[model samples]
Target: MQYLPIFTKLDNKPVLVVGGGDVALRKCRAFLKARASVTLVAPEFCSELLEHASNNEVILTQAYFDESHLDGKMLVIAATDNESVNNTVFELANKRNVFVNVVDDQPKCTFIFPSIVDRDPITIAISSAGTAPVLARRLREKLETLIPQHIGPLATLVGSFRDNVKARFKHFADRRQFWEGVFDSSVVSKVQVGDTQGATAQLHGMLDAKAEPEGEVYVVGAGPGDPELLTLKALQLMQQADVVVYDYLVSDEIMDLVRRDADLICVGKRLGNHSVKQEDTNQLLVNLARQGKKVCRIKGGDPFIYGRGGEEVQVLAQHDVRYQIVPGITAAAGCSAYAGIPLTHRDHAQAIQFVTGHCKKDGQELDWPSLAKPNQTLAIYMGVLKSPHIQAQLIKYGRDASTPVAIIENGTRKEQRVVRTHLGDLAQQIEQHHIVSPALLIIGEVAALHEQLAWFGSSAQISSFAQPLTDVA
Candidate 1:
C-alpha cells in the first residue's frame, strides 16, 4: 500500500520523458498507450523513438534535461541510464510538483510503473510499490491466462449501456444494483462467448421488461472448486446475481466466473475465525433481496448438504421473499469422483452416507454404530481435525481397523492432492500430507478405488474429459 492505486485518465495530458535509450522508449510507449501527449527530451533518440517521433506520435526535443521541459507537463518520467541526469530530472519535476517516475530508482521516484494487463476498456494493474517488478509481471502473466480474451469486448459492451442504465435507474444504489443484475445475466456471458447478437437480445429484453422493485435470493451452489462443474441453473442464477455472498472454499478461479460488476461479499467461515456470522450473512441476503436486488448466496458444494442453504432459504421464506435454490456439485460427491473413488460401489458398498465431523456444540453425540457399518461408504465433511476420533469410534463400532480411507485436499481444484490409507493410519497420513481444510474424507472399500479412477490430475487430461459445449435448439 505504499502507492495509492488508481487509473489516471491521461487523455489530452502532456507527459515528459527524459531519455533516448531503451528505457526511455518503454516509458514513451506506456504514455502513448495511456493516450498521453508525450514529449521526449534527449540529445539523441533510438531507432524506435525516432520512428515514433517521425510518425508524429511523440514530440521529440533533441536536448539535455532542463527545468523548461517540466513546464505544462502533467507527468514526467526519467529513464536515462545516467544516474546524475535521472536525479536532475527528478529534482526538476519535484520542484514543479509534477508526478515523476525515475526508472529503477524507487527513492527518487514520485510514482512507479506497474505491471499492466490491458484488455482495452478492462485494464488490470499489478504493482508491488516498486519493490518487486518481476513478481508483478509474473502475476500479471498468470492473470492473463485466467482472464478470457473477450473480456475487453465485454467491457466495451457494458460501457455502451452505461448511459441507458443511468437513465433508467436514477438512484446511485439502484444504478449499482441494476449493473450488478446485468452482469449476472446472459448478456455478459453471451458477449464473453462471442455471441454479441445474443447479448444484445438479452439486454434489450431486460430493458423492455417493466421496472419492478421486488427482489429475490438464489442460494447458489458454487460447486467443488471447478467453475465448469456448476449446474445450468446455478450458472443462470450467477449471471443474474446482483450480489454474491460467497464462502471460503470458493476458489478465486470460480469467483472470477462471476459477473465482473456484481458486488462480491466474502462471508467465508474459517476455523476459529468468523469474519461474517451466519445470522448476519442470512440477514444481508434478506435485506438485499427486500431491496429488489437479486442476491446470490453462493456456497461451496450442494446448498442442502452442510451448506446452511436451508437456513438461508428458511429466513427468506419467513420474510415472504422470493428465492430459488441452485444445486451445486457437493464436495463429497465431486471429490470422490475426481479422485477416482465412488461414494457407492455394488460389491464394496451397498449404501453411501454423508455426515458432518463436527457438531454445533463440542462433544455432541452422533450415531457412531450406524456410521461404522462395514458395507456402507461414508463421506465425512469438515472432519479432518476430528479424523482420529472418528476413526476410533468407527473401529469400536464393528468397522475393521484396516478399513480403507482416502483424504482429498483442495478437492477438484488445480492444487488438489489425494492421500490413501487405512482407517487406523488415516490420521497419520493426513498429518504427513499436511492436508488442510476444504477437504473430504472417505471411509470404506470404495476409497481404495481412487487410484484406479483418478483422472483430473492435469489440465490437458481434464480438457480431454470435458463434454463439448453443444448448441441448444
Candidate 2:
C-alpha cells in the first residue's frame, strides 16, 4: 500500500494552517469537523474565515507565515498560493517531525485528505494514495446510497450492551453466538426503524433467556416489476430470510436479490393455473414459523392491496407467530408514474379507485353505478380475462363509450407495453395487442395523458402483437 490507513484521535489537538484564502478556509473546515483546535497564520484572511474566528471556532494569528508558527502544533497545512512560502512551511514542519500537507503538492504532503462517507459513528474513508482522488469520491458516493443511515445508532446501541453481554456469556464462543442471533433476530429490524428502546429491551430479554429463539415472517411488498422500487426495510429482510415465499407477480429481477442459500417456495397464482392453493399457502407460512425459520413472504405491489397479504397475516396471528409488514410501492402508483399517466388529475379525475377483476368465489358483485360515475379514475388489477365484461357493464351503467382507456402489460419493467384505446374498444385493443396476464387497466380521462405525459417508457407505446407458433405431432 502506498499509504497506511489509520484513524487519528485529533480531538482538542492543535493544528496549524498557513494562508488566508479560500483554500485555507477549506482545510480549516475539515479540521473543525474532526473537533481539532485550529490556529491559522496569515497576513490577510477572507470574510468567511474572519466570521469563523469571530465565533471562536478557530484562533487567528494575524501575521505572515514563519517557522515560529509551527511550534507545538500536531499537524500543519500550507494552503498559500505562493510556492516559496508553502515550501518553507513543509520544510520547517518536516524538521520538527510534525505531519504537514502542502495543498496541491503531492510530494510535499506527509498526510493527505481522504474521501469520506460519514454515517456519524460509522465512517468509511477511501483513499487512492493521492493518485485517484476523483475515483475515490465516486466510490464514496456509491457507498452513501447503499449504507443505511441507522447504522450509527445501531452500533451505539450495541456498544452500550457490550458489558452486560460479556457478563452474561462468560465464554467467548457463546458470546459470539449470542451476537449472531441478535443480528438475525427482530432486534436488527427494530433498530433499523429507529425503535432503539424496543431493541434494547429485546436484547436484554434475550441475554436473560426470558425470550427464547423463535421464528418471524416479514410480509413484504416487492413493488411492481421494478426491483429499484423495493423499500430499504424489504431489502434488508430479504437478505436475512432463511426461506423466501414468492408469487408470479414479483419480477424475476427481484427474486435474484433473495439470500442465495435460502430455499425458494413459489406459491404464485396465474390465470387458470394456481401453483398452490391459498389455504395451503397460509398454512405453509404458519408451519414454517412454527419450525423456527425466518420466512419472507414477498408479493408484488402493496401486500395489503390485491396481494392477499392480510389473509396470510391473519393466519400467522392466529398461530401466535410474530411478523412484520413492509409496505411496497403499489402497481397503481408505480405503473402510472412509469407510463406517465396520472391516476388522479384535477382537470380529469376527482377520485381514484383500486379494483380487481378477479374475486373470491363468494365475493359480492361490484356496484356498476358507482364504478361508472363520471370524473373518477379506475385502476383495475388482473382485468385481462374480464376485459369484455368490464367494457359492456361500464357502458351499460352510464360510463361514456368514448372514454379513453389504457392497458399496461408488465408495468414498469423494461418490456412494458401500454395499449391506449377508447372504452368502446377496450376489449378489441387487448385482443389486437395480444395482451397477456399481469396487466393493469386504467379507465378515465387521465388515461388519455399517456400520449402527452408518458416519459419513462419507450416511445413505441405499443409492443409487437406477433408471437411465434409451434407445431405439435
Candidate 3:
C-alpha cells in the first residue's frame, strides 16, 4: 500500500494550508469541518476565504509560500497550482515530522485525501492509495447508496448500549451472541425504517432475555441479481446469521449487504463443478447449529426451485435443528418482471409452469406434451444449453412453432439483457445475443408481452400498457 488508512482526530488541532485558490479553499473547508484552527498563506485570497479571515474564522498570511508556515502545525496541505511550491511544502512538512498532503501530487505528499462517506460518527473512507482517485470516488458513490442514511444515529444507539450489554452478559461469546441477536431482531430493522421507539423497545426486550434460546438456522434466498429484490425476511435472517454459506451465483452486492463480521464460507457449485460436496455442506450446517450458531444457507434466487433447499431442510429435520425458510424473488419471477415479460396473462397464457431442463442419471423424459399445451407459459430454468432439444421435443409433442420466446441474461443485474424471438429460432437468437448463464428462457404467448412491457432493458422501450405494479410492503 502506498498510503496507510487512518482516521486523525483533528478537533482543536492547528492545520496549515499553503494556497488560496479553489483547491486550497477545499482543504481549508475540510479542516474547518473537522473543527481545526486553520492558517492559510498565499499571495492572494478568494472572496470566501477573505470573508472567513475578516470574521476571525481563519488566520491568513498574505504572502508567498514559505517554510515558516510549517511551524507548530499538526497537519499541512500544499494545494498550490505550482508543482514546485507544492514540492517545497512537502519537504518542509517532512523535515518537521508533520503529516502533509500535496493536492493532486501523490508522490510528493506524506498523506493523500480519501473519498470520504461521512455519516458523522460512522464515516467510511475509500482510497486507491493515489493510484486511481477516480476509481476510489466511484467505489465511494456505490457504498454511499448501499449504506442507509440513518446508520449514523443507529450506530450511536448501539454504542450507547455496548457497555450495558458487556456487563449484563459476562461470557465473551455470550455477549457477542447477545449483540448479534439484538441486531438481527427488529431493533436494527426498525432503526433503518425510521422507527427509533420500536428499535429501543426491541433492544430492551433483547437485553431482558436472561437465558435466550440457542441460535437457529435460516435458509435464505438472495433473490435474482439485485440486492434490493431481497425480501425483508431474507435481510432480517442475514443480519442475524452467524455464518453464511453462499453460492457462486449470489452477486457481490448481496454478499456485501451481509454483516461484516459474519463468517462467510463459499460452498458455491459452478455449473458442473462443486467446490465442496453437498454432503459436506449439510454436515457443516449441522455442526454450526449444534454450536448454537445462527447459520444462513444463502442461495441465489428462490431456495427451493433448483436449489437443494428441500434436501437441506430434510437434513435439519432429521437432526431436529431449529430453522426457517425465507423465500426470495425466484429467478423466473424476477427475470420476467425486469425483462418486461409476463409469465401469464388471461389474453395469452392462462397458466405458468417452472421446469428444470436437467434430469437425473437414469434419463427419464419430462412431461413435454403437458408443458407444450397452449395458453400456458413455460419458464425453463437451467435450460440454455438444452434449448434445441427442448424446442425439438416440444415441437414433436405438438407445441406451436410460432410461440414467442424471450431469453433473459444476467436476469435483473445491471448488465442484464433480453432477446425476443420465436420458439423456432430460440437457440439462434440466444447465440446472437451472446446470452450467458444464470439466464432463463420464457416461452409462450405471454412472452410477446415483453414487446409492450420491456422496461428494464435500455434498448427496449416501455409500451403504453406498461404500468407500475402495486408496491409490496
Candidate 4:
C-alpha cells in the first residue's frame, strides 16, 4: 500500500489553485465539480479562466504565487510552469500540514488525483501511486463499462430504508442475511428495469414477511498443508461462516483467511493430545446451527479419507442440520506429488493401498498378507510410531526386505523433508531422522522413483541422509 485511497467531501470547502493558465483552469474545473469554493491565483489568466471568473464559477486573483494564498484553504494545487513556484507551494503546504498537488509532478505533490469512474453516488477511484497513470486510467475505463448504471440507484433506494431495516432486525447477522436475500430476489430485477415503485413495494413486502431462521454447516477440507490447495467453494464458505471449527492439521496460513470476526473453535487433535473430544465437537456443531449460526467445520485433506469428516456429517444429518461437504486433496496424493513419489506407476506398481498404521485402538492389525503382495504401493498415514511393527509384519508376510520406501515429513509444506531408504530400514530411517507426526510413508518399488524424479523441497531437505543416487539411469 504505497498510497492509501480515500474519498474527500469537498462540498463548499475552500481550495486554492496557484496558476491562471490552461493547467490551472483544468484543476479549477475538478474542484468546482466537487462543489468546492475554488480560488485561482495567477497574474496572467487563460480565456476560459476569465470566462469562469465572469460567471462566478471560480474567484480569480491577479497575483503571483505567495505563501499567504494558502491561508484558510482545505487543499492547494500548484499548476504553474515555473518549477520554483511549484516547489515553494509544496514546502509551504507541508509546513502547514495542508494537502497539496502539483500538476504532472508526482514527487512534488502531497496528494495526486486518481483516475475516477463517476456514477454519481458510486465513484470508483483507481491509482497506481503515480507509477503508471496510463494503466490506472485503462483500469478505470474497463470498470466504468462493467459496472451497471442501476447500482447507484439501487444503493440509494436501499439506503433510504436503512433505518427502518435496522429497527426491524436488532442483530447485525440477521440484517446481513436479509440484505443478501434481497440482492438474490426479484427486487434487484425491478430496479434494473427502472421500476422503482415496484422494487420499493417488493422490499416492503419482504420486510413484512416473517420467517424462522435456519442455519447451514459447511464441512470444508482445508487441503494437505498448502493453503492454495483449498477449493474456491471452501474459501467462500470459510469467509461467510459465523463460526470456524478447525483442526491442528490446518496450516496457520489457511486459518488467516477465515472471516476475521468469526468465532474460532479448535477441535484440533494430535497423536497424544486432544484439545476437544470428537463427540463434543459434533454436539457443538449441532447446537450452533440450531441457534441459526453458519458453522464452518474445517479439516485437513479429504474429509472422508482419514479426516473423520463422515462421522461429523452423520451427526449433522441425525440432528436434521443442513450441511455441504467440500472435498480436499488427501495427504497420500498431495505428499506423493510434493515428494516426487507416485502412489502408483505402470512400471513399478499397478495397485495402491491407503493404510492407517496407527489405529484408534490397540491389538488391531491390517491385512498384512494382501498388503505385502508384489507390484503394489502402500501409503501409510500416521505410521511414524508404528513403523517398526509395520516393517516387521510386511517382511514376515513375504514382502521383500529390499523393497524401496520413502518417508515424507511435513509433506507439501516449505519445511517438507523426504528420507529415502529400503523397506528393511523404514523404521531405522524414521528413528535416525527423528521423523514426527503428519509424515507419510510411501512403500513399494514406486518409492524408489523419489530420488530420480524428486523436485520440490530438495533444497529444504536435511543433509544427513544416506547417499542419494544422483543419476536415474
Candidate 5:
C-alpha cells in the first residue's frame, strides 16, 4: 500500500493551514468539518475564510507563512499557489514531525485527504495516495449511488441498543449473532419506513430470544485470472463471508477481495498435487457451516466448468448446508476474448467444445472422432501436459494437422502470453515456450484470429508469435 489508510480523529485537535486563497479556504473547511481547531496564516484571506473567521470558527492571521506558524500544530496543510512557500512549509512541518499535506504535490505530502462518502457517522474515505485524485473522486461518486441512505440511521438505531444487548448477552459472539438476526429480520424494514420505535421494539424482542446464527456457503467463481471478470454477486458474497475456502486456481487478486477479517484456508488443488483431498474439502465445508460460519468456497473460472464446483455443491446439498452459487466467466470465454480468438466464428467455426486435458481417475478417454470434426473450436483447459497425445489423437481422427492453434499462458492476466502455431506443432510450441499450468489451448481455424484481432497483450509479446502456418503432412 502506497499510503496506509487510516481514520484520524481531529476533534478538538489543533491544525494549521498555510494559504489564504480558495485552496486554503477549502482545506480549512475540511478541518472545521472534523471539529478541529484550525488556524490559517497568509498575507491575505479569501472572502470565505474571512466569513469563517468572523463567525469565530477559524483563527486567521494576516502574515506570510514561516516556521513560527508550525507551533504546536498536530497537522498542517500547504494549499498555497506558491511552490517555494509550500516547500518551505512542508520541510519545516515535516522536520517537526507534524503530519503535513502539500496540496497537489504527492511527493511532498506526509498526509493527504481522501474522497469521502459521508453518511453522517458512517464515513467512507478513499484515496489514491494523491496520484489520481480525480479517479478517487469518481469512485466516491459511484459509491454514493450504491450505499443506501438508511444505513446511517440503521447504525444509529443499532448503536443506541448496544449497551442493552451487551448486558443481555455476556459473550461477544452471542451479541454478534443477535445483531445479525436483527438486521436480517423486519427491524430493517421498520427502520427504513421511519418506524424507530417499532425497530427498537423488534430489536429488543430479538435480543430477548437470543437466536442462534445460521451458517451458509457461497460457491463463488473467481473468474479466469482477472479480478474484474468476477460477477457482482460473487464479489458481494466474498466480502460478506466469515471464512474463505479457496483452491490454487483462485488468483491472488481475487483472494484480496475477500473479507479482510475472514479466515482464509487454502485447500490446494494443482494438476498433480493436492494440498487437501476433494473429500476432505467437502467435509471441511460441511463442518465449517455446521459451526454457523459463512464460508466462501472460491474457485477460478465458472465453478461448474472444470472447477469441480458441482461435486462440492452436491456434497453441500447432501448435508443440507445452505449455499448460494455465483457463476464467473470461464477461461474458455475469458481467455479467448482477451487473446482475440473468438471461440465460435461465422466462417471459421460453427460449433465449440470445452475440454479438459486431465482425465478422470477411472481413465475415461476423450471422444477423438467428435472432437476432431471440422468447423469447430475446442477450448482445452489444463491441456499443456497432454498436448502431444491430444494433437496425435485429433490428427489420427481426421482433423487437419495444419489447423491453427493458440496456447494462452496465464490467460486474462497482465503477464498473459499467446503462442500461435498449427495443430501438428502443438506439443512442440508448448515445449519450446516452456508453457505452464493454468494455460488454455484454443484449437481450430478461429485460433488464427489471435494474430488478426489480438488486442490485450503488449506489442512485442503479441507480435512475437506471428509465425505463418505451414501445411503439415
Candidate 6:
C-alpha cells in the first residue's frame, strides 16, 4: 500500500497553518474540528480568518512564513500559493519529523487528509493516496448512503457494556461469540427503535443468562483455484467460522478470505503424502464442534464431488452435530470454462463421467468397459499418477488411441496450464511436461473442441500426436 491508513488523536495538540487565504482557512477548520490548537501565519488575512480570530477559534499571526513558526507544532500545513514556500515546509517538516500537508500538492505533502464519513465515534476514512481523490470521495459518498444512522448509537450502547461483557467472558473467543449473539438477537432492534433503557435491560439479561453457545459445522466448497468462484453462503460461513479446516487443494487466494482470527488447521492430502489422516480429521471436527466451536470444513471444488465432503458430513451426523453444506463450482466446470473447453459438445460428446485415478486398496480398477465407451467425456480427477494405466486401459478396451485429451494444471488460476494431446500420449506428455497434482484430465472428442473455443492463460499443447494444435491455457 502507498499509504497505511491510521487515525491520529490531535485533541488539544498544537498545529501551524502557513497561509491566511480561503484554502488556509479551510485547512484550519479541520484542525479545530479535531480540537487542535491551530495558529495561522500570513501577511494578509481573509475575512473568514479575521472572523475566526475574533471568535478566538484560532490564533492569527500577521507576518510572512518563517521556520520559527514551525517550532513546538505537532503538525504543519503549507496552504500558500507559493511553490517554494510549500517545498520548504515539506523539507523542514521532514527534518524535524513533524507530519506536514501542502495543500493540492500530493508529492510535497508528508500526510494527506482523507474523505471522511463521520458518525461521531464511528468515522470511516477513505483515501487513494492522492492518486484518485475524486474516486475516493465517490466511494465515501456511496458508503454514507449504505451505512445506517442507527449503527453509531448501537455501537455506543454496546461499548458501554463492554466492561461487563469482558468480565463475564474470560476468553476472547467467548467474548466475540457473545457479541455476535447479541447482534443476532433483538438488542439491535431495541436500539434502532430508540429504546435505550429496554435495550440496556435486554443486553444485561442476556449476558446474565449465560446461555451455552451452540456449535455447528459448515461444509463449504472453496471452488477450483479461483476465489471469485466461491458461493456467497460459503464465504459467509468462512468469515463467521471459529475454525477453518482446509487441505492442499484449497487455493491461497481463497484461504485469505477466511476470518482473520479464525484458527486454521491444514489436513492437506496429496498423492503418497498425507499431512493428517482422514479419520483424524473427522474426529477433530467432531471434537471441536462438541466444544461449542463453529468449524468450517473448506474443500476445493464441489464438496460432494471428489472432495470427500460426504465422509465428513456422515461423521458429523453420527455425532449429532449440526452442519450446513454449501456447494461450489467443481474443477471440471470451473477449469473448463476458464480454459474455454466445453465438457460436453453437441457433435463430440453426449455424456460426462466424473472419475478418480486413485481408489481405496490401490490397483482396484474402474469399469473400463463403460469408461471406454464412445462419445462420452471422462473428467478424471487425481489422474496424473495413473495416466499410463488410464491410457492403456482405454486403448485395450477398444477405445481409440487417438482420442483427444486436455490436462489442466492449477485450473482457473493465473498460473493455470493446459497441455493438450491424444489419449495415446497422455502419460508421455505428463512426464515430459513435469505435470503436478491438482490437475484435471479431460478425455474424449469434446476435449478436441478446446482448439476452437480456446481462451484464458498461456499454456500450449505439448504435442497433438494425431493432429498438431496451438496453445491452450
Candidate No. with top lDDT: 2
Q: Can you write out model 3's per-residue Cα lDDT over 56-79, one digit (the tens) per residue? A: 889999999888778889889988
Q: Which lDDT values do the candidates have, in the order given?
A: 0.83, 0.88, 0.83, 0.86, 0.86, 0.86
Each model's number of backbone clashes?
A: 5, 0, 0, 0, 0, 1
Tell me each candidate's TM-score.
0.55, 0.89, 0.56, 0.59, 0.62, 0.59
Clashes of 3: 0
- Candidate 1, residues 1-473: lDDT per residue as tens digits? 68998889999799999999998998898889878999999999999998998899999999988898899998999988898999988888898899989988998888888888889888999998888888999999978866767779988888888898878878999888777777655455467557898677667667766444457787888889877788766766676677888988888877887877899989989978989988998899889987767788888898999988899899899999877777888998888887888888899999999999878877677899899888899999999999889989999988998888888887777667778888988788878778889888889999888767766644566564343211110
**lDDT by residue (tens digit), candidate 6, 148-238:** 5677998899999999999999999999998988875556645655788977887888899854554668899999977888876687678
Clashing pairs in 6: 460-471
Whose lDDT is higher: candidate 3's or candidate 5's? 5
Task: Return the candidate ranking by TM-score, descending.
Answer: 2, 5, 4, 6, 3, 1
Per-residue error at 227 for model 4, in Å?
A: 1.3
After superposition, the stretches of candidate 4 with alpha carbons farther than 4 Å from their true spots are: 1-206, 457-473
- Candidate 3, which ten residues in sequence have the lowest lDDT sum? 464-473
* Best by the TM-score measure: 2
Worst 10 residues of 2 by lDDT: 464-473
**For candidate 3, what's the RMSD?**
10.9
Task: For model 5, give the 10-residue run with minimal summed lDDT.
Answer: 464-473
| Cα-lDDT of candidate 1 | 0.83
Backbone clash pairs for candidate 4 read none
Q: Is candidate 3 or candidate 4 better by lDDT?
A: 4
Per-residue C-alpha lDDT of model 4 across residues 65-93, encoded as one tens digit per residue: 88999999989999999999999999999
Q: Which stretches of candidate 2 lie over 4 Å from their true place?
A: 46-56, 104-107, 167-172, 290-292, 317-320, 456-473
- Between candidates 1 and 2, the one scoring higher on TM-score is 2
